[model samples]
Every structure is written in structure tokens, then in C-alpha cells.
Target: MAEVFIGSEEVAAGRVTRHELRRWYAPVYRGVYARKDIELSLRDRAIAAWLASGRKGVVAGVAASGLHGAPWVDPDVPIELVGVRIRPQHGLVPRADRIASDEITRVGGLPVTSRVRTAFDMGRHLERTDALVRLDALMWNQKFNRADVRALGDRYPRAAGLRRLLELLPLVDGGADSPRESRIRLWLLDAGLPQPETQIPVLATSTRPVAWLDMGWRDYKVAVEYDGDHHRKDRKQYVKDIARLRMLEALGWIVIRVIAEDKPSDVIARVEEALIRRGCSVEVDDLHRFARTFAA
Candidate 1:
């Protein structure tokens, strides 16, 4: 919609008074105002805040995550700004950390942290599973990979969370389609299961593609699929899922379905059993490596 501006700008335009500023423009920040009719998106809010900061704010944290095209971040999450020393205020997370010029970029003319830096910061600030979720989405959306993260870490050797980034780097995979998919993949990895290839193609007798497994071990013809809410709520999607699973089973594949309600340990159990049934071995100790993550 319309570009939001500071009260001084509207006053300079000579089209509005304080009464109009109060009535027609909604306060996004103390002095920044957006037209009342316009719905503010995260970007709009970020821009409003930057304007409120006298155009000196550089977006960071989860706010920057959204700017980089990663989804599932809370919309109500505070807009984070970093430029100079500042204190947190309503609807804003401010920091005075050193940010290189190259670390800044723009989306729709609003300043934001670069994708690699955004992800690197997220890895430090967010929980491990949450960070992986954002990282997976970032990779899928931006075509970025682990190398970028490594390079950023190298550039900022003394930066916080380098160890966390290194720990998460091995877990990051672009093939995950949703946060749940990313979590499932990580759970399996933490349990010491064989790394499953994502979005694996199931070939027909003619060697043509029939379906793609969400995650699979080709040797065992086992697939793990995470069904989101849409799968159950949409009738057409339900029917297609039935047909697809039947086709997969007909091809001598074992399909394991995981849902949001499934407990992490139970999920590991089911998949572990399936792998064993297919004549594959699993390390017993590996199952407990990630046990502490679920203790809470």
C-alpha cells in the first residue's frame, strides 16, 4: 500500500495536523505513522521502525529471517533493529553489535541483515530445532548452503555462537518442506539412524517416476512422511495421499507416517523397527545420543 512516514514528514508535506495524525494515521512507533486503512506486514512494520529510528536501523534476528523469505516465524515477534547502542522498546529488539557493511542488504527498500548473517544469528539466538527449521527454509528459498555459513563464521571469528552454528551446519538440509519435516529429519539423525535422502523419487517398472518419498532409504525402500494439518483437512489431499501410499506399498516399500501428535521417542521406535524389519542394523547407543533434547 502506502508508504508510512514520520510525523515530521507529514507535517512538512502540509497536508495534516496532529489531530489528523492521531485520527487518520495509526502510530507504528512513537512518531512514525502508517495510514489507518493499510494492513502492516512484518516488512511494513520494519520500515516504520527504521523510519522512526531516523533511517538508521538495520533489521536483524527473526525479523531478518522473515526478510530472507523463511516462513513460520511468529508474526507478532518484535521487529529487531541494530545500528548504534540502543535499548529495547515496545515492538522492537535493538542491539549495538558490530555489523559489517556487507552484512546489510535490502528487501523492498527496507534494510535487513544478509541471509548468511541472518541465519548465523538465528542459530545463536533460537533453539536448535527452531534454528534448523529456519535454516532449512532459508536454504530452500535462497539456494544458500552450509559453505556460506562457514564463510561468515570465518569472517567473524570472535562472534558468538560459532560453535552452535557448527553443530547445526551438519543438520541443515534444503530438502525439508516444512518445520515438522525438518524436526523429523533431525530427530532421526540425533538417534543415529542412517541418513535418509530427502524427496527421493520412486521409480516405476518403466524406470519413470511414480512418486517422491519425503525421506527415504533406497536400500530398504522405506519412506518417512510427515502429514501436516492440511493433509487431514483437505479431502482431495487425503484421497491423493491414500493413492500414493498404496502405490508405494505395491512397489514393496514400507511407508512410515509421522504427525504432529507423535512423540519423538515413539517416532524413533517406529522407524527403527521398520529398518530392522528390512534387515538393516541400527546402533543401540546412537538412539540415546539425542535423548537429552527431549528430556524437558
Candidate 2:
């Protein structure tokens, strides 16, 4: 089969011989196999992990996020599962967390954590920055009520990382287009600046929206934009961005453009200066502390 399957089961069912499996399929786990010619995606790997668990585990965390159609998931990330007690392998992580029946749902006939449950698990289990990034991506794909996840936390009052999860809930915004944008937003918030709105729309003469700012204060007309390499690499996008920036400036918008090489402190300073120039006051001492922590 082109898809991931249990090699021994296929052999037992007379679907394929042991020699055929060995020649045409590559082992993904202890007994899981996929066609050698096919490229395995994150879902395939997740399914393989489930098969490795003998179909007993429910996929969770980033794996579940990916299965729910969230973008930007690293295909190589280890698949996380709940409700299984299998020994750890190269690409599978088995967790013993308490998962409720409502928290699990079937995607493509595979049991995966529901969107809210996946977000909850991710926020509690992953590092803060990574958790926010994944949460933004997941929320961007699937609209879920934060209160639902909070209720889950209330149910598991003493769950590990519950406090951290509560703290992170307020920062979760689905409008972020990229992880870098989310990071920049976090930096501004940590610097004691106002929480800038994401994907702020600037309208043209007509009712149609002309451009969307990455993150900005609408009242102050100040925006922070993270420019990835693709903006410069793609000639068409570069030309379009130049035109877009000019239009935004004409509309009295102060855009702070950030690139990969820019230091975090410099980016924050630029944004802070722009906001201040646009009549938004920020605490300089608090910002300096944040900058130092970011630099460290």
C-alpha cells in the first residue's frame, strides 16, 4: 500500500508477502511501513505513530494541530499521543495525561484530540514561545472559544502547567500570519506597550480593503511588520510591497519594518519610537528591562 500500514498485518492478511514488504516498503516505526517511493507528510507520520500504538493512542499536541489543518507545522516534529503506554521510539511521544472522551475526535478514521483540547495540551506542554506560535497557527485554522480551553483547565485544576496556560490564554490571537509576527507581538507586549491589533485593515477609496498591517495600534497609526526572506526573494512581491508601503505612508501610517537580521531591541525601539511619535506613551524603563531580557 502507498499509505502507512502495519507490515505484519498486511502479511498475515495475504495483502503482501514479507519479502515484498521488505523490498517495496520502508519501516517508519517498529512495525509500520510505507511505500518507499511515496513521501510521508506529518499526517502520514501521525498515522504511523498510531499504528505503532496498535491504534490505541489518540494523537495530540502539534500533531493534532497539524491534522486539524493548521499551517507551519514542522513535518519532522515527533508525533505526540495520549491514551497509550507504548515505549518511546524515534518519532513518537506517548503521554499519560488525563484525556476525556469529549476531548478526542476522529479525523480520517484516526482518533485525534479536538481543537480545544489540542490547544490546551500544547499551551501547557510546549515552551512558552513555541506554545504561542502553535496556538496562533491552530486558532488561525480553526475558530475555537478560549473559554472552552479555560473550562478544561478548570476541570483539571492541578494539571501540570495550568498556571502557565492561564497566563498564555490572553495572548493567544488567531490573526497572526506567521510565527515571526507572533514573536514580534509578544515582544511589544512584554515591553509594556499596548497590545497591538493584528491584521489591521487599511481601506482604499472604495469599501474594499487595500492592505492589512501585520500588527499595529489603529488609534496611533503605527504598525510593526516582520519581513521574511520571501518578500525580497520574490521580485513581484518585492515590487508590490514597495508600492504598499508608499500607500500606507501616504495614509499617515508609521510602519516599522523588521527583517531577520534586525536585533530584537532595535525592532522594539523602532516600534516604540513610532508609537510615541504617533502620540502613544510607553514606559521607557519597563521597555529597557524587556529589551535587556530579550537580548540575554
lDDT values of the candidates?
0.83, 0.89
Per residue, candidate 2 scores C-alpha lDDT tens digits across 45-133 of: 99999999988999999999999999999887899999989999898999989899999999988899999999999999999888999
**Candidate 1 per-residue lDDT over residues 7-56, each given as its tens digit:** 87778788688888888888888788888887878888888778777788
How well does each candidate superpose onto the true structure, as a TM-score? 0.91, 0.94
> How many pairs in model 1 have backbone atoms within 3 A of each other, for residues 3 or more apart or on separate chains, i.e. clashes?
0
lDDT of 2: 0.89
Candidate with maximal TM-score = 2
Model 1 is weakest, by summed lDDT over 10 consecutive residues, at: 287-296
